[model samples]
Target: MTDDRVLPRAVLWDMDGTLLDTEPLWGRAMEEFARGIGAEMTPELRNATMGNSSVDALTKVYEAARVPESGRDFEADEDAMVARVLELFATDLRWRPGALSALDLVAGAEIPMVLVTNTVREVTDVMLETLGRDRFVATVCGDEVAAGKPEPHIYRRAAELVGFCASECLAFEDSPVGAAATHAAGVPAIVIPSAIPVPPKPTYTYRETLEGLTLDDLAAVFAAR
Candidate 1:
């Protein structure tokens, strides 16, 4: 059967787990931070904060680890976490399987791309320098928005930054939280699971990898959805 699906006018890309293999780095920093406080960082703890912002993740960390922290103290702890993670991110950043290739494919197709993520701008600024500022036309960091993932504010802001309605944009995510945020914003989000596998959801489409994906492949998926 012939497919006549309309293509998205733009694309929204998730950083951290999706575009860059920084999930492990974040996990390491979380573990080290816990060590400093005499708290254990377990797999369950990592899972809770895998795709979360400093604010979101730290609350879970403090709760799960039973470490009492005030709001001001929590911010200090977050700063420490970011400092440790940023040190690693400055040197070690690998692309997820097929992420760079897919990015090039989308860029070559001339689709406007926006880097949208729950990561704060301090780390993201470092990444833009390493990944080349030219890769994305716009970026929406979690710190810049009123709320982070699963809230849709950042995705909505990203869509606005790209000058497209959320419906006209395609968001590529690697985690359930990020995917849900894009979906909530009325964007059709495609999830390529990272180290943390996102279960099948009715709101978004799932793919194993972004590698070797073409515009036609994307169009087919969009139409199928």
Candidate 2:
């Protein structure tokens, strides 16, 4: 990403493990789901499924847990996980470091922003309500797309919702799967590692945290792109 000297038309945000410290919440849910399926939540398995969509995560966990991927088990377990997270969200929703401040900075600037997440709407909507129902102009969730992160549909839709193409947007992501989706959407992404460790990737640039992030910082990255 060399200095392209261009400005993004919109900004996109990832929810779980990004704007919110919800990975642990997801972990709790995952553990419950695992136990229900006669599996265990090993660290490796947790890491593997961290940023994935419900189906993808379920499939991976199920495979790793050696659970037969048969019948409606996937959907049933997904609902269980969702239920667990919803219950957690109601009382323990935590914010990621500098998340709200960064959001306020962008919102104050009047740049339209959107929450783009692989999380299903059942959870994302509740998080948005806490973030402030009107904080984002739009939110594109996993359930809205034909495919989730690691696939570009959600990001593409988010960019569209904000009246811009993905190439004209700046996306913030905390997970490699989400980052990959942003990158695939032709959106230059700023990744802030959370819940799961992100291996350094040359395709997308990373920030240490949302703390001290400025619109100028975003433009600098855009310029370099």
* TM-score on alpha carbons, each prediction: 0.93, 0.92
Give candidate 2's whole-model lDDT. Answer: 0.83
68-169 in candidate 1: lDDT tens per residue? 555337767878887888889878888888888988888888898999989999889888876667989998899998999978999899888888898888
Which residue pairs in candidate 2 have backbone atoms (N, alpha carbon, C) closer than 3 angstroms, thus clashing? 2-224, 3-223, 3-224, 4-223
Given candidate 2, what's the lDDT at residue 190? 87
Q: Per-residue lDDT tens digits of candidate 2, residues 1-225?
A: 774545568889988888888888888888878777777888988888888999999888778668664644867677778887899888898888899999998888778889888999888877877788698888888988999998999988998787887878888899878888887788888899896666665557788899998877877876676
- Candidate 2 residue-wise lDDT at 110: 78
How much lDDT does candidate 1 score?
Answer: 0.84
Error (Å) of candidate 1 at residue 10 is 0.8
Model 1 alpha-carbon drift over 4 Å, by segment: 1-5, 69-72
* Residue 83 CA displacement from its true place in model 2, Å: 1.4
